[model samples]
Target: MRRPLRILQATALALCLLTTAAPASASAASSPAPSPPSAAEAGPVLAVPADLAAEEVSFRGGGGLAMRGTVLSPAKAPVEGGPGRPGIVLVHGSGAGVSRTKLREEAVAFARQGLSVLIYDKRSEGYSLFRRSYPQLADDALGAVAALRSRPGVDPAGVGIWGFSEGGWVAPIAASRSADIAFVVLVGANGMPPLRQQTWAVAAGLRKAGVSGSLVERAEPAMYRLIADGGLFPEPYHDPGPTLAAVRQPVLGVWGVHDLLTPPAENPPLVARALEKGGNRRYTFHFFPGADHAAHLSPDGGVTRLPELAPGYADLVGSWVRDVTAGRTPVAGTSGPAPVQDSATVPMGPAARWESAPVQLAALVLFAVAFAAYPLVALVRRLRGRSRRPVTRAARLLAATGAAAVLGLFCYLFYVLTTGAKLAAPGPVAAGRPLIWLALQVLAVTCVAATVLTASAWYRSRGSADPARPGERGERVRLGLLLAGGAVFVPWALYWGLLLP
Candidate 1:
């Protein structure tokens, strides 16, 4: 169908920086467009090649869920019961609510190029009211392949899958499951473990949005620990290298230089190495400069896109697929030598490992304990029934500051996950406005002030003739631990990209 190409969803998937231009409404969030048109009719309404026809179809998806699929076919076809034309199945990214309406243009685009295209609603849509899992989504794509093969104009021997973003991970496994998969196209595929990629992207986004490099650097160990300590993924992070290495089909990996969601610096190399090791000489990898995750960039830095797909991108994908089906050597995806790569590019590697996990665990634990120091001291005083002592106003303020910093640290982590992870920025949004970043600043100031006061308290306590409840020795030890906790808070604050100074 000739239609507009537009997708509005959460950009938290953008690799780095905690920034995203917020969407219009909660209804328009990354989930599929709400109240999508049903698989109502049996025919497509969009314009396609004069010799092709379009129709809405449904098939059994993963777990026997009823999935809605749109099939585009050649109007003039080989005789019935004969082998048909090469087919391509378009798999969606992480959009759980992806619908037929959102995919008609893409399906028509490929069909116009003389290939049968099957665009289907993801498993999250119709049947199997279960939470989405990779195994199931891969099964859904495989099911689409089966559904396509069942069609009159689809060639079973020439069928393949093309996926983007999360699809990058799903498509490979679908291809690996059966040798029947003739080829694969991965758009912005991820090379590292899924969670690591996500965390790195979060950190990278923070660094891009005015966060200090030093703070970003210091946060890695704790971020790494978040992964190894579990709760990050349904399973241990999925290392895509092994799965990509197992694919024997002809493959094409497409990426963009400016794709924050999938770092172009890393994904291209990782896919190249894995495909090479798998002995898949049929694999071709292409990188486009100045494009975002979708192979196009917004000049004004807003999501408003150019009417056309990125320069040479649509042609690159269409032409490559045609070549694959035609038994010709696929184009290298560029006329001249590749564009020069960025010098600051970072590669994809394991983020947290067993060796590092222990140290991170200890640091995180002590920090949490340190976070409790203020409370612990108060509780001690309460139980001992100590009368109020004449501590300096500076000491009282400093102690309270220490407690507040601890509380702020806990609040800060929650803030990142709640705001950045689920919503837009890591700040409160009022009247659709993202409040300025102040949480980190508050924590940082508190940490600095706490450090000085704790030290000063320690200095004065050491020389006191009459120590209060804890006495000199006990008071000295408590003060020292408080100082140590404050010291740890400084780095932890920096790690969150809080106060850079």
Candidate 2:
């Protein structure tokens, strides 16, 4: 429930942001007439170095979208009859939608390590949102693959992809689609099914914000369903297992032991199991002790300055490319201990993508209709000049209490979805917390009171039933409203873990 609500609120936020950003985006695209990049214009490392060559390049994606990036290759020409210089295309992470320049650090570092690397702008940056489907993203990646393989010194047989975060999911599927891909490097990848991974991510986030573990567990499924309907990323039905198994190439998995962004702790083992089960013999997994998502960290995790790209992170990946392409067997790490978990069997099952979207949408519809009924009825009565109902005081209180309770729960949901993630970062829930934890604390109390009050009214009204009642229609409507609102509010309250300690 929390995750889905977060996504919904976030989508609304993105649309709002896009409206403001549209003009800037248009201006940038239309006004762009910069000269082609020269050696000096390229950054320090990317400049024409003695050992490296950088080229401004572009490739046609699905529907001929011109995705652009820089391809960096070793200046040393490939030796004839020797293994072609190994190469890799950089697959974008979730935020890869930012811009091509966002990947400069990774590209330059890999280029320095002596591998041909392609870092391209993600299609999502300029393409229509609806057109950026899984296959289309994969197609864009494959386009880069083709471009990289065609590079002057790149070995067509040794070129593959290095994917981070969501790219992890996209890269494997792209690789399995063709034998052209030689190997895969998955960094900060989640081995969990997409939906499960997202749900777990939301749950962990809540826990970090001081949400209790038990409540997080309770709220996870409802949140999963919410995500199914309208989450940011269209949940793909990609089961990474079969695809991971299908890859005949040696694979390397990198993770940070303390990573919460993608929860690397769980996924590395999952990746290994599936690969081994699928008959993939050469697999290497490495864990870093003190890194977060994006593989960046500080000595004590305080906020750091720009270019916090993890030390030696890119080098590890670059080294893997060096070893695999040099005809040496894949090593566990560039210089770390062997993989903690050896190969094992991973249970294969259907992905949780959209499994609960329909039912969750049904619940939202029910709540919406029920929430609107009373106000619409009151407006009609006012316009028609109907007299006020002579309902008993108890029934009126029930209606009031129920409405208040529903209002509280709805507000809390809105608050969490809007501000929880940002506010959760520094530490414990603070006084200036956006959710107004006190309001939620008050909401929890009022909801309990409403539940008790409504139940009491319901029981007492039955005993006082009068078939000849004058305000029978209005009274019945109000009673139904109270019951309906309570029905919606109670479960929502419970699902959000609002009633928990």
- Give per-model TM-scores: 0.70, 0.75
lDDT of each: 0.61, 0.61
lDDT value, candidate 2, whole model:
0.61
Worst 10 residues of 1 by lDDT: 1-10
Please give the RMSD of candidate 2 to the true structure: 6.5
Model 1 / residue 28 / CA error / Å:
27
lDDT of 1 by residue, 72-95 (tens): 876767677866778888888765
Off by over 4 Å in 2: 1-51, 75-84, 125-132, 213-215, 230-233, 300-308, 331-411, 414-471
Q: For model 2, what is the alpha-carbon lDDT of residue 42?
A: 47
TM-score of 2: 0.75
For each of the candidates, the C-alpha root-mean-square deviation to the true structure, in angstroms, is: 9.4, 6.5
